[model samples]
Target: MNWLGWLHDFFTDPAHRSGPDSVLNRLLEHLAFSAEALALAALIALPLGLLIGYWGRGMFLVTALTGVARALPTLGLVTLTVLLAGVGDAAVLVPLTALAVPPLLVAAAEGVRGTDPDTRDAARGIGLTHPQTLFQVCVPAALPTLLAGFRTAAVQVIATATVAAYVGQGGLGRYVIDGLATRNFATTAGGALLVVLLAVAVQLLFSLLIRYASPRGARTGLVDDPAGSPALLKESV
Candidate 1:
């Protein structure tokens, strides 16, 4: 059958909709794995990032770690972990966590740094403590940048979570891997669609979240043009 025919079968088939190895189950697994990694990354990156940005310290550490993460190939890292640690979820999770961290860290740091200094000073003028200035004053101003980083990391994690299947774990990738092994091109194509759809969904979800969560100035696009809205950061504060 052609692509259109396969797609119809892929979506309509009851087996794909329900069963232990169903597409839905695999998609859930994929989501779970990606969420786990992203959560861990956020836990590690957010506090450190917030502190680094607030203190204007650890820039070198963040930059170096981010650079190393970006330079490391995902497939190679996954494979190496599997070889060194032996095949299992750890093989996949470690590398995936590594893959997810950089964006979160960068966003956290940049958002903190990008705050309007005058706004920060004004916050200080109000007798807000250091912690208060960082959280109440600066963090809100940095929301746009932080949200952008979060969205990027989420999309990437969803796309890459397929690596789980290679390590004998479940994920949307199972379809692709199994299909390829058995030469079932339709299943492989369907899996690809699922991954892409999930990634898009994540992006859309974050966009809406950012829209509602953002200060009005940022939602209006002032965040994109720093010079155009010098006061917007202060307004955010």
Candidate 2:
């Protein structure tokens, strides 16, 4: 059958509706795996980024590390972690979390640092304490970019979570792996379609968040370094 025919059958397949490897089950597994990794990445990266960006400290270190992380070979890392971690979700989780961290960490730092100097100073001058200004002033201002980065990372994690199947963890990726192993073109295409759709949905969700949550007032047009901070853009210092 053609790709379109296979996709149609994939959606209509009764087996996909119920059972251990059902569509619902694989989707849940995929979401859980991706969400867990993303949550951890956010917990670690956001606070550190906010601190460093607010203080204008550790720019080099944070950017350098994130860059290195994004460059790492995800498949290779998963393989190596499985060798040491010894199977189960740990193998996939380690690399998946690693994959999700870079964009969040870098964007968060850059977003915070990119806050207009005037806006930050005004917040401070108005008796907004450091914590107050950090949370109220800076976080709001930095949110659009932060969300943008998060969107990238989250979608990436969701798509990449399919690799979990390699370690015997069930996800939509199982269809792809099993299909390829058995030379079942329909299952492979269907799984790839589901993953792509999920990624697009994640991106759409973040876009909505950026639209709604972005600050108003001075944050309207060129507000808060729309591109990024001069500090972030600079090669050094």
* Local lDDT at 224 for model 2: 30
Give the alpha carbon lDDT tens digit for every residue of 124-152 in model 2. 99899999999998888888788877887
TM-score of each: 0.89, 0.89
lDDT (CA) per prediction: 0.82, 0.82
Residues 118-184 of candidate 1 have per-residue lDDT tens digits of 9989989989999999989888888877777778888888898888888899999998898899998
Q: Give the TM-score of candidate 1.
A: 0.89
Model 2 TM-score (2 dp): 0.89
The 10-residue segment with the lowest total lDDT in model 1: 225-234
Report, for all candidates in order, the number of backbone clashes.
0, 0
RMSD of each: 4.3, 5.4
